[model samples]
Target: MGAHGAPRGRAARPAGEDSRGAAPAGRDGYFDLLRAVALVRVVAYHTFGWAWAGLVFPSMGVMFGLAGTLMARSLRRPALTVIRGRLRRLLPPFWLWGFFVVTAMLLHGWMPDWRIVYWIVPLGDPPGSAWAGQAWEIVWYLRTYLWFVLLSPALLRLFRRAPLPVLALSLVPVAVLTSVPPPEGRFGGALTDLATFLFCWLLGFAHHDGVLGRLRPLAVVLPSLAALALGGWYALTHQARYGGTYDLDDNPLGQAFWSAGFVTLLMYAKEYAGAVGPVRSRLVTVFNARAVTVYLWHELALILAVPLTDRFWEVPAFERYLPLESQWFLFGVGWVLIAGFVLACGWVEDVAARRKPALLPGGRAARMGT
Candidate 1:
């Protein structure tokens, strides 16, 4: 459920989506398209259990790369300032979401743990409770992002001084995490997940530094393909190792290499820029404008739709066909509910960002954030 393809740690979209604005003359439409597609893919995959989609696009990789690139750009401003601004933008809507979730769970008879205070303002993966586990799981992305953003000043400096070595060092975590089982503990596992994607995050730094764009396309492309191939081979053989599942998420080492390659290719920076039509433009605007709200609330909609759809299944005509259980039908329900949630809560993102509010922030209004 994490919107994986952008600067999503503090904000939902990449730095491209950092501002509420129009094309601004030089912005690429495809990044917006990439973020939009990644957001949809994360929600759809979570809803439909689409493992192939993760392999196909690797939304988290795309997101880390996007975030890393943007963080690099933001480094021009003071690091402390950048972190503060990001937190200010991120926390308000998140606090609102947390309040609703916690209140609901409390109403359902959850005894509050004093530890529950962490979830109220989570900096690491918020500990999930028995009552609303699925919703709490999404916090992993934000929590990991929090640490990465906090470390960026140093990480970026290390990367700048010794680009190749720093990147190679990043992959070391991938190897350690992948080859061995993480000791059973919250801190250990969180670090492992952070390591799983660390290389790609650094690769994002390389992209921002022009390391990727300067290379021959074949230099990046060929190695990335080879790494992906190796990842596939490793996963193919390890089917016996995991619970007979082919999910790459379970294979931390393989995913790190694969995502590093993927991010490298995506951030090659020299890739040609493109544009889309008015309708597509509006869609991108809406997606970026409400990205954080949508990412947070879409899964809630999916969870609620599960019980709601159960009622629909009781209809005699639809019972036979199981239309209510159809993947497409569930996706449609989630999408519509998400739209309504966006209409209701998206203004929080705007108000938090100090951007003007609109039911659909598009066209000239989208550009107003400059």
Candidate 2:
């Protein structure tokens, strides 16, 4: 699955539906909307480098929670089958994106070694040319997500045996890391990310198992609000330690608690149980379908946008008429390029999903062969 995109499968019926008269199994529009918003927030955060954006949405945690819910749903089948299906959906789009990135790095005089193989599986942070910039940072999310998927079978079993206790215990690793000096380098970074989001991931299991739904309204709301408060308080007071900002990304414990609280409430509500209306449904479908492509290519698009926008300054008419220097203009250009990549490369997701390829998903043309 993409960092911000969950694996898609038929969701379990919502809480109130009677099985006999239940509507057919279908997409959860609420979950789909969360993902679409996460992807958009990711692109916007990367483009604008906004600190408060993390507070506003906390995209990574939400994505992990959603992925965990879907992963639990899929584990109804054989474990090996579920894992294989996930890898199949995830890797092809990555390989296609890697082809261009790795080739670019090599052309820029990047020396290859055994570490280059990480690009193939990305079990670790993949090496890239410095010239490639922060584009490669997105791989951390993929690496973390892959770890979650692989461990989920065992995690789910343990979660089911004792839902509340295991869910509470999930916070231990992050708590320990936050108290002590974290380890240095790639392993530490990966461990921090895994630990940080582990709570949210298990919260997904809680949501799936009806644990949250079974709880009283106050039980769910009070602790969640308290968490949100503590996380906000910590971030506010501890800003100077983290580059003089309260960006959740800089504070693992804050992010973990905040995201856990925020995502839990969203998942619990199960709002918009049916389709999120017509036009929004189509947009959600496109976002979920091409999620991998959007995430992998978005940074590169933003990188390319800078030079492309710079070129516009040379044309007097464009420089005067356009907000050429504004980050908003760059954001717009980035999405335009993202749309181009989706048309050019997004079909790999369809192929991976065993659906007929389409330039854009959820359209009449894509519907033709299905």
Candidate 3:
């Protein structure tokens, strides 16, 4: 039996130990579940309205926290090795998806509409005054991810020597500079969004430093839950006053608090819930194994699903019309298309990984399957 009394295959450790040769047994299943949940939350939050908005931002923070923890362990490598590893893992898949989207536009005869989306979709500027179109909204995450990887070395070094309070306080300037007042549109300002990235990454660093294990779940959960409840209420109450926009500062604070609570809850889930059933575990494992592929292909999946389904069923004209029922339907349709792309386009990334494993953290290839 695995740690949870389930089979041992659920959370597969990396093919080998980390670069520093540490044992991989310390892996956390809850973190895997959390990543899976966070990816879903992102899709759902944007797709299903704000029903779970309280969870999504914090979940991302949890992911960043986890990433930071891992980074903390790897900062000692030579600069070339670090840069190479990160680029190999992050870029190949990104480039493949970019090509796919660009091709789709050409085939659909929508090349002219590409001008605005071209920017935001490729981690460049958002369209003129308006936000980029739906086909490419997910790029925001990718754009931020690129920035994080670029700064990982410096961030890792700074946190390695600094006191916890010093590192934590170091983020204040970033938070303040980013937290300008809310904009007119529901769109979040770019400056404030940085706070979310820093907050999550720092949390990850702390997690690596054994911070969560120091606090009981209850201690972490209570205040976080309260923040989400009250903070959300406050945002909604004043959201309209800000011209339908949600404040990024308000959003990140709520998300950070909530993320801490969820991370604690996940730790408990592993200790208590045990195996999540074999079939479910296997399914989640497959999805998680190809996580980067899934994330990279999801946007393309959405774009492709629209046209094929459009022949028979029409997508809702407005974003609001997409409810749970509609989302589930879309989810079903999306899986079929994305699965095929994973087999084909995803292979492109695997090839690059094999050729230059050292480009990823600790010189590891992203595993495609068990």
Candidate 4:
């Protein structure tokens, strides 16, 4: 659903420790793996438009949770320093991506107004040509993320003061919003999204602070399952009201509770941090490194893949060999483009992090080591 910023310095403490009784000292692969999977699911859901995908893996909530955990870790330093660092890491990649998108929109006859500044800071939804609307719609995630980063210092303090009660109360906003008639404009939409995922974001805070670690397994599991069931039940019962689909994105109250329960279990099981093997670790690294590039360009890739796939039909040999009409083929082609974007644009992330740019993250180091 969105790209997550990685935390620098030490990882969060796991629920359990090894014989040495120390936490992992570098990037947390379990969190990385969750983020990578969430990114993939976002691409897949967009390409396939599957409603049940939200239930299976609430990608947006998962991403916000990962970002929240990392934000909490980074906030151990001065709040201003952490926030500036996050924005520095986040914005350049966005600006670079926006350059092309905005240029294309302008070429397509989009007349700009004062609101075009949203393309820079994205505190609100940025405008785009209707033809490329899908690409711009994803900016809402970044907008929400920016707001979270800016607000985390205060949110973290509140959570630390009363972790359980604050966590429980985080769901109230979405419930209240959903109980009323849905809001009508961009601000309303943003509010709904923020309230829907605020609990998961706080769950990340809870994870980083080791709040969930102190809970009894049953205490965590029972409530989480109950919430999950309630979310599913609400979606099922309210389908007709929400375009006759069970997609969690269509139901804020359902998404809030569903993602809360789902992400809570994930953060609660931090022991699996060590379960990731070497090959998977490298893959996770790349995903985390290029998350912004991949996320920003993925919709464009999917959109372009359609026309490209249609072109393949003109070549008899290509038509014979490729399943050009299948959605799977489009999915595969979309990833191929995503990989290309990662290779082309991912180095911006390295530069933003103040590291040397490489085709792949750590490519230079790996070569030097060899």
Local lDDT at 205 for model 4: 85
Model 4 root mean square deviation, Cα atoms: 6.3
What global local distance difference test value does model 2 have? 0.82
- Minimum summed lDDT over a 10-residue window in model 3 is located at 361-370
Q: Tell me how candidate 1 scores on lDDT.
A: 0.72
RMSD of each: 7.2, 6.0, 8.3, 6.3
| Candidate 1 Cα RMSD after full superposition onto the native fold (Å) | 7.2
User: Please, what are the lDDT tens digits per residue for candidate 3 over residues 324-361?
Assistant: 24666666677787777666665555565564322122
lDDT of prediction 4 = 0.82
Off by over 4 Å in 4: 1-24, 271-280, 363-370
* Candidate 3 segments exceeding 4 Å error: 1-27, 50-59, 106-132, 166-190, 216-230, 241-253, 260-280, 313-327, 355-370
**Model 1 pairs whose backbones collide:** 4-63, 5-63, 6-63, 22-367
Better candidate number, 2 or 3, judged by lDDT: 2
Q: Ten consecutive residues with minimal summed lDDT in candidate 1? A: 1-10
| Residue range 1-370, candidate 1, lDDT tens digits | 1253222122233322322132234434556667788899889888888656767878877777777766777677788888987777777888888888888888888776556766655665565567788776788777777778888899988887887678868878767766676777778778887898888778867765656534454666787888788777776678777767667766776677777776666665333121222325787778877877888888899998888788887788778876775888888888988999899888888887777877777756343111
